[model samples]
Each structure stands twice: as C-alpha cells, then as structure tokens.
Target: MDATVNACIGSDRLFDSPTTMNASVAIESEMKWISGMRPILSEEDFFTWMSLIIYVTLFVALIGIISNLLVIITCARIGFSETINISYLALGIADLMASATRFYGSIFLLFEITTTKVHFDPRTVSSVVAFLPSQGFEKTAAFITAFIALERCLCVQFPLHVKTIVTKRKTIFSNVIIYIFAFGPSNLIHMVYRFKWVYNATQNRTVLAIDQSETRLRYILARALYAYYGTILNFTALIVVWICTVYLVLGLKRKAVARKENFKTSFIKDNKQKDLQVIKTVFLLAVTYLVCSIPTAITLLVPQFVPEFGSTRALARISRVSYMISGLMMQVNSCTNFFIFLYMGSRFRKALITLFKRH
Candidate 1:
C-alpha cells in the first residue's frame, strides 16, 4: 500500500493546479453536485456488497492484528533464550502493525467511498495513516525475515561463530536499525507534503493534492526510493533466503546419505522430517511475499506508461479496478502472515495455542 499511495499521488498528470482552471465555474459546479447528488444507498443493492466486503476485511484485519499481538507478547514472555526466536517476535510485531494500519485505513477508505463529501485530505491523511505505516511495517517485516535467514545461514555455515555472535542485544539493536531505515524516508515525505484540499472538477469534490512543486519533488523522490531501493532490497533478501533454504536442504540430504551409509537407521528418519518442515515454511514465506507484492510494484510503474494507454473509459475502469485489487492484495499481505506462522512455525503455533488457552 505504501508503494500504491506514492504512485497515485506522485503522478504529475493526476492533479494539476485547480487554481489554473476557472475557479468560479469549478466552485459553482461542485456546489451543484453537493446540493443534487443524493445518497444512493437506498436505491442501490451494490451498497450491501460494498458494506459486506468492507466489514469482513475490517473484522479479519482486526482479529489478525490482535492475534499477532498476543503471539508476540506470549513469545516475549515465554520463549526460550535464543536470538533466533527474537527474530520471530519482531516479525509478529511487524505483522501486527501492518494489520492494524490496514484495518483503520480501510475504514477511512470505506467512508470516502460511501460519502458525498470527501472527508479528509487524501494526500496528508493517506501519507500518515496509510503510506508511512505501511512502509514502516513492510520494511520491518522484510528486515526481520532477512535477519532470520542470515541467522539460519550462520548457524548452518558456522555454528560456533553463531553461538558466539548472535546475542539478544544484537538482535534488538538490529531491529531498531531496520525500523529506522525502513520508515525514515516515508515519514520524511509525509512531513514534507502536508495534505491540502483542492477543488476537483471531475469528481465535483474537494479532493487532496500536494499543491506545491517542492512537495511534489519530495513525493517523487520518496516513491522512487521505495520502488527501486527498498523493493529491490526485499527481493534480494528473498533470493538469499531461497538459496540458503536450498543449501540447508541439500546439506540435510547429504547428512541423511551419510547416516544411511553408516547404518544409523533412525538418524536419517527423524531429522529429515524437521528439515522438510523448515523447507516448507521458508518456501511458503517466499511465495507469500512475491504474491502480495508484485501487483503493487507493477502499479507503481503504471503511471509512467499510462500515457501510452491513452484516456478511454474502458482503460480508466481497468486502471481503477487494478488499483482496488492491488490495495486488497496489500490487505491480504497483512492478514496472511499470521496464517503462515500457524501453518509453518511450531513456536508460533504453540504460542498462539497457549494464548487461546489463557483467554
């Protein structure tokens, strides 16, 4: 969602200075719509569909966030003193943040959809309430996953070195650095662009705009930073994880071969199961990240080539639908991490079970 909002707002063609247009005609036309456009909920059956989906998404996001928070808290309190486990705790916190942000952000979006008046400045509110939080949580999750991969790599490649260097303090410090790096650019962009109202002739509503050249520059820079650097970094880490997982699986296979040769019958059987479980978990995480993120990434690049597509009604509708679908995918990203933990991680599943038992 961070990437989507930035892409939408950063498009120079999307919002030109309304002040350049005839303000008098714009104001009169906007007022006419305000006076005439009645609420369609009474007449429209589709309102029910919209309402149902919004409510369901909100409920799922809320529950997912709460469940993740409980997992993080429980793990913090009860997890063993392993630096590797600390990474899972950080991941839970990041997932919870993403889920909570999506839930509240979706409420605002639902209001925007249903209301006659544009309630809030989309640029500013979206920057703070939607973009910044999304970027923060996403980057945090990415870094935490990368750190987990690195830890696993170290453990597999140099067990003695991992035992000596992977400390709790180190993990905490790394988490702090990841958050600062992840959130810094988006927050800075929000501060620079402070949202303002602009009269939108097409929509006949007071919509939000950046409204200044300097702010536009900042928005573009921030969007570019995330699109190129942050996303690339995430993809790189994902590749590293895949490679490391494969390496680990191969190593386990070699060990099984040796154990079989030595006639250690049980040694190959039990540990192979554990190795398979870990492989499945890592593969799921990788696939989930790719599926959730690719659409948003493509959306970020859409504006650059939109002129090539031209301005047809069908094209406009397609673009709008794509944007909505991409936004939904982001919400799925926030909610699905918990399910991944439930299915893949024994520790997370145990923690969740304990949490439910207590409640």
Candidate 2:
C-alpha cells in the first residue's frame, strides 16, 4: 500500500529533520543485519519482527497470484460466450493482474531490503516500481467490481431491458473505458508530482526530493490529488457497489415472495433463479471488497489528518506493521473472488470440476 510510504514521507515532513535520510538508511542497514546474523532485542526486535512479516506477505501474495490465475483460466474455458460470463472472465483477469502487481511489489521490497545495499527510497524506487502499477490495478479492480454490481442490479431490477442494454459489445466497451480511466491522466500527474533529484548546494550533492513544488500550497494540492486518486475514487465505487447489492437483494426477495404467493411478475422470466444466484455471488464479492478495503482506507486517511500518528518512532513502527496487515488483507480480497465463485456460483463450481475432468 502507498499508505506505508506516504506515512513515512508525512513523518519526515513533520520532523523537519536533516538526518531523516541518514536515519532511514541506518535503520535499513541495521534491519538487514538483524535479519541476517545478529538478533537485536532492542526497540522490540524491529528487524527480526519485520523479517517475519516480509516472509508471510510473500507467501500470501504467491497464493493470491495462483488462485486468480486459475480463476481466469477456468472462466475462459467454460464461459466464453455468455455476456456475464465474459465479464467475470474480465474481472478474473483484472484480479490476476492485480495480484501479479502486488506480488512483484512484495518481491521487489524484499530484494531491496535483503540484497541491495541502497536504502529503500520511495521517490525513485517505490514510485516507479510499486506505487503506479499497484494503484492502476487496484483502481481497475474497484471499477470492475462496481461495474459487475451495477450490471447485476440492473439485471435483477429490470431483467428484460438489461439484456438489451448490456450486450457483449457494450460490456466490452465499458471495461475498456474502465481501463482507460484507471491508468489515464491522473496517474500521469502522479508520476510527475511524486519525485525528483534536486541539487543541495550546502550538501554539495543531489538528493532525492519527493513531493517538492515551488510553493507549499501547490505541494499540498499535488498530494491531495494523489490521495483522492488512491482513496476516494475507490471508496466511492465501493459505496455504489454496496448500495447496488442491497437493492438487488431486496428485489430478489420480493420476486421470490411473489412467486411463492402465486403472483406472476411481469419481468424477464427465464433466468430468475440464475439471476438470483449471480446476485448472491456479487453480494459476497461486494462484502469481501468492503471488508478488505476499509482497513487500508483508514490507514491511509487517518495519518493525513493526524500527522502526529507517524511522528514518533514507536508510532511509525506500529503504523508500518498495520500497513502490512492491511495490505495483506487487500491482496486476499483480490484473490479470494475465486473462492467466492466456488461457494456461491454453482455454475462456476461445476465448470471448475468439468475443466479438471477434461484435463
């Protein structure tokens, strides 16, 4: 999560300490040494503790990648022709890409801390490698989730019109638009605003400067733009998905009740049961997304308002650990859609079985 790096940056600004870079490098070297040979019991065994965290994060990310990939292949093999099926396939691919990005970020961080001597710098290393790709994929996943939720809500609320409205071509078009928006101009702005190497005349060298602007106000504005991109857009989509899920559930219940009372409903008749099943599946997906995302959002948002949260060493350490846990949860959410499909979508489960049997 960018929250981790952002928190560090925020902390650096608040302290206004010239030794911040040196302190960071010393900490990194100490951590590497601790993870290697000597075990330091001071400062709550920070290095040893963080090493455990890195290993655990790596394991979970690998599992996530494999699970998302399997879902993609299964969906493609079994569900090539249906519109909703194709959407699920697209969502699965998006999930796979997301997991891959996260997995790469995790490996890169480990490599930097374990192998590379240079201190971890968010400006140059994180921005280019982890920050942009992860955000792109995360936004893509969020938008596609909202897309699926909206499609299901419409199909349940107005079944007949939905078929005409949400054709294969239109669905594909919507996905392309999502991809474009997820990786478009705002992200380019982020790449430009994040970092630069500025000459320090006093130090007689170039130092990596992040979020530097001509004016403090402009710097704040730049950070706000990135923050909104990272948190707000995704949260808005989550809220929409939640609302759509609720409407869909109520609609499904009403129809089920009407059918029980022998009252015929004037809507699409052929796929009520199937549509209900899909609604159930999407409902689970929405809930999972909310559960996993809210923690990360909180982690990112709170520190912005309470800069003091990361001002102290102890607090910063705690924030780092919290960031890792929340990050893992987000990754799990991205990968576990496959399990949700297996649980709620009987068709998906049967398809998986058939796919394996064929092989």
Candidate 3:
C-alpha cells in the first residue's frame, strides 16, 4: 500500500530541513499525504471520502489483527517440522505485523478526523512512525509469499529431491534473511531521521517534526535505498511471484492432462490428489497476492516513468486517490490470508479447531 510512501519518503522533496512545518503552508506535502487539498473531489468531498476510507482501514486492521493472531497461534500449535509450516508460520507473522501497524496508523488518523481542533497532526506523525514499519512488514510479507510460491514450484519441478533441497532448517534460515532484507532499510531510515518538538505555525503549537541528522552522503544513500525498496524490491518480488505462479499453474495443468490420459492405482491416485491439494493451496495464495499487489505497484511505478507525477507535483491530487485505493487493497491482502489458510490449509484448520477447543 505504501510502497510509494514508505519507499520514496527518503527521496521526497519535503525532506528539507526537518524544522517544524506550518500545517497550512508546508513547503511540500508528502506522497499519499493526508491534507485538506481538493483532488478530483472537492475539499469536503475529498475529506469525506478520506474519512470513510480511514474508518474502513481501521476496521480491516482490527479484523486483520485478530485473524492473523489466530493464524500465528494455529501455526505454532501445528508445529513446523515440515518446511511448508515454516513458510506459513513466517508469513503469518509478517501479515500480523502488517495488520497491527496499519491499525496503529489508522487509529491516529481517525482521531485527527474526529477532533474539531487538534494541536498535533496525527496523520503526519503516523506517516513515519506507523507507515514505515507497516511498509517493512508488507515488504517482508511479499518476500515470504514469493518464497512460498517458489518453494512449491521447486517441489513440483523436482518432487523427489525437493524435500532434501528445501529442508525445514533451510526454510527457517531463508525467512530470517527475508526479514532482515525487508526491514533493514526502513530501520536505517529511523536512525537517520530523528523526531523533535518544534513549533508548528499552522497548528499554533509545538509538535514533533521529523529532524534530519545525517551527512550529505548519508542523505543521498538514504534516497537511493528508498528508491530501491519502493521500486526495485517490490518489482523483483512481484516478478518472482508471477513467474513461479505461472510455472506452478502450467505444471498443474500438465498433471491434469496426464491423469486423464492414464489410469492410476488407488494408492497412486490418493497420493496424487494430496499433492494436487497442496498445490491448490499455494496457487490460491499466489493468485491472491498477485491480484492485490497490482494497484500498489502501479502507484510505485508511475512516478518513476512520469517525473512530474510526484507526491508534490502536478498529479499529486489524483495520486492521493490512487494511494487510498492501493492502501486499502494492501490491508485487505494482509488480513485476507488468514481466511485462505483456514479454508485451504487442512493442517491449519485442524490446529485452529484444537486451539479453540483448548481455550
């Protein structure tokens, strides 16, 4: 959802001196930034829509928090001796993190919206504190989803050897590395930009402003990293998921054809059915990830091609709507996985039932 905001914050023109900004006369508004400026909609209309969206996001985040917690608990109880369990467990954790952060950010925005007058800009504060971590969790989830897809593809491609090649220990190590890669850049950004109390002219009060405490070289590096995370990192993960998903689909189709052409014994038939069921679960997951990601990807990619299409540029207003759409989809994606697991993952379902019975 915030691939653009989270990834492009470092390179934003608004990163001038981190001095306190006048809420009304800030030199630059951030991408997907919350403001009273009218986009295609009039100011009142825009804010109404934004308010509705913020409320919806808050609802989704709450549901997601509960759902993902269940997924985590179920996965833990199910155990992770199997490599697939390890991936599922990691994915649950990542989605849980994403949902929690989204909830945190959404609550702040809701407060800002409802209050008649506010001293601090809750949306502005959330942009950094909640969005950055949310982005990291989203990115981490993307990588783990892609990893799940790729792992399944390998298993299908090399049935006998895959178990040995993709062991549980190896899966654990891979998830750890994915977490590091996804979160490292965002955390680095936290270090470079420190928040401080500064007088905001628009609010007529002191508020925490993001203060920069880095050298010129570090600033440039941060920009490059942000650009990479926003564009290249997401692009790579999306492409990988796409390719793996296609490969798995084709393999399944070919197997279907083979099954129709040849007769198998009951034992063989049962085993093949089990394999197909597993593939179906992964296929559903990959497709869900792919469909949900396209909107966010467009927001991230469009600015790269159209230099004028920035958070502070000519197309800023239109892009806010796009951001709203994309943000909602990503949140849906984060929360939606638990249901997927519940319906498709037999082991997970059993574990969840057992968990509920225990409680």
Which regions of candidate 1 fall more than 4 Å away from where they truly are? 1-60, 116-119, 122-124, 159-161, 195-234, 245-255, 258-280, 297-313, 345-347
The residue-by-residue lDDT of candidate 1 on 1-359, one tens digit each, is 22232122212332211101011222222223343343332213323443555576688678768777776776776675767567767777887887787677666546544443464544335445564466567666766766676666565566448667888898888988877776565455545455677765534677765554565676576556545333565556556656665666666565555545655567766754554565466556656765676765575456567752213322432343344445556556666766776877776677667777888
- What is the lDDT for 86 in model 2? 72
Error of 3 at 295 (Å): 0.7
Which model is ahead, 1 or 3, in terms of TM-score?
3
Best by lDDT: 3
Worst 10 residues of 2 by lDDT: 14-23
Sorted on TM-score, best first, the list reads: 3, 2, 1
The parts of candidate 2 lying over 4 Å away from their true place are 1-42, 115-123, 185-225, 261-270
Task: Identify the leading candidate in terms of TM-score.
Answer: 3
Per-residue C-alpha lDDT of model 2 across residues 1-359, encoded as one tens digit per residue: 22233223222221121101112322333233432333223344544555576577668768878888878888877755667777787777777776776676666555534533333443344444454456566667778888888888887777669879888999999988887877553355444455657664333566565544446654565456455555667667768877887887788877777545543454544355566677788888888887887777776677779764444443545555556566677777778898988888777788789888998
Estimate, for each residue in 14-58, the C-alpha lDDT of model 3 and write its tens digit: 221111111211114443445554445444554566678778888
CA lDDT for candidate 2: 0.62
Name every residue pair that clashes in candidate 1. Answer: none
